[model samples]
Target: MLDATTITAPIFIEDMEVGLTRHLEKIISDHDISLFAEVSEDRNPVHLNDEYAESTMFGGRIAHGMLTAALISAVIGEQLPGHGTVYLRQSMAFLAPVRPGDLVRAEVEVKSIDLRRSRVTLDTRCLVDETRVLHGEALVLAPSRG
Candidate 1:
């Protein structure tokens, strides 16, 4: 159901390898949180209101888990199986809070490939200052080059 604009130059099934990996780094910001809230319509108080968030276990505002997860999407779409990779499934565990100003590094590593179906499974994780804040796996449909 993705529109034409979303697809990019595919890496193709043959071009991918089992050990392929990619990483992207970003600093969580208030603006990023606000935009994510607006776009995703997930206006949780813990992600926006500092005072309210202070009352929670997080002690202060934290970014949406999905925002950090989206970095995995960015790696899949723009790096490893660059461009035409279509995400089929993703399972993530939020291990730690991602607060604003926290520099996060998202990483994806190819775990296995189903050549017949052009499917790829990858291990995904995100770290903030060397602490693993998230971990998961992803399934994607890679585009065919030919």
Candidate 2:
């Protein structure tokens, strides 16, 4: 098991700055949608059924919004304040639907930092081409130097 006390955060709180940004990209695939549906138990037809989805407002099956949002989490944990950071809360707004095969780009920017509390707030977003599919803010406890 990993020990939190001994493990140092990849980027310490003192090193972070406003406007620091990182991006990650992935193509939403049929396999991804299916696995996410299975893992989340969100068998919504709009995400899994073709004909049924065609009857809806979107007119096509789409990837689960949370699946796209997961990319934002990836950018945070693997990129920006990477590794040892701890997520406190996330507020998301789903702006558009992401269809399978869409190339999703997740971006995160450090908006504010509270070094005294070892916390940081970031602006998070996911885009498909020029369209924003999801946007949000995330609060996390950053790793410390000491």
Candidate 3:
């Protein structure tokens, strides 16, 4: 069985801080790539076919970028700003490729909060072995617990 842990507690708009953060770690697998392709209909050969990927700049198959980013989503939806949070928008830049066996750590830190608007802006990033693979920001509508 896979083990998991919460890097931070659930947060609400009333309790969020500009520096609050959370994260999770997971290993990318071939099964994950296949399932993501099926659900997203992103059947790019580079993510599925080893031969095709070998001829590309990545030199081998790589996980879908969005799939890697979903780690950020998992943290947002399940940890910080927990349940009842709704994603408003996200922007990302893929800095490196994530392979099937790569272990990735997805993290998020609150950058600002608009209490009146019930929104939180967070700095998002995914890293492997201390090297950043993805970096971005997200806007989310935090739940009102009051």
Candidate 4:
């Protein structure tokens, strides 16, 4: 957990100019996949059976799109515009498949800010190497000074 006291300076319009970057290297663990599968109840063979996955066009087990999208939440909750940030909406497009061993990274840039309204617009994307796996825009309510 981050120390709030360390963040002594008030977040302002100028602070929005700084974008945050993160590299997520943990391979999607089997336990994580199993939990997601049970929760979503999506027993797609490509996700569950390695033998079946080898027969598919993807040629291997692929992670769920929603699972990849969840990285966006981590970026918001743990990284930039963190803690007090409230999500207004998110629009995303999945461009490629994500296999278990592939490392996915989420990058977010503050596109616009409405200080009076306490809203911020972010351009977000998840990528594997140079190939984009998912891209989107997120609208979030920035914390207001009381």
Q: Give the Cα error of residue 90 in candidate 4, in Å.
A: 0.6
The clash number for model 4 is: 0
lDDT of candidate model 4 versus the reference:
0.77
Can you tell me which runs of candidate 3 are displaced by over 4 Å?
1-9
- lDDT tens digits by residue: candidate 1, 1-146: 13447755657778889988888899999999999999999999999998999999889999999999998888888877878688899999999999999999999999999999989999999999989999999999987766
Between candidates 1 and 4, the one scoring higher on lDDT is 1
Candidate 3 per-residue lDDT over residues 1-146, each given as its tens digit? 12356444457799888999988899999999999999999999999999999999999999999999999998898887877799999999999999999999999999999998999999999999989999999999998776
Model 2 residue 101 CA deviation (Å) reads 0.4
Find the candidate with the highest TM-score and give its number. Answer: 2
RMSD to native for every prediction? 3.6, 4.0, 2.9, 3.6
* Model 2 Cα lDDT, one tens digit per residue, 21-107: 989889999999999999999999999999999999999999999999999988788777988889999999999999999999999
In model 1, residue pairs whose N, Cα or C atoms come closer than 3 Å (at least 3 residues apart or on different chains), thus clashing, are none
* Local distance difference test values of all predictions, in order: 0.90, 0.91, 0.91, 0.77
Per-candidate TM-score against the hidden true structure: 0.90, 0.93, 0.91, 0.83
Instruction: Count clashing pairs, candidate 1.
Output: 0
- Candidate number that wins on TM-score, 1 or 3: 3
Question: lDDT at 52 for candidate 1?
Answer: 100
Candidate 2 clashing pairs, residues 3+ apart or interchain: none
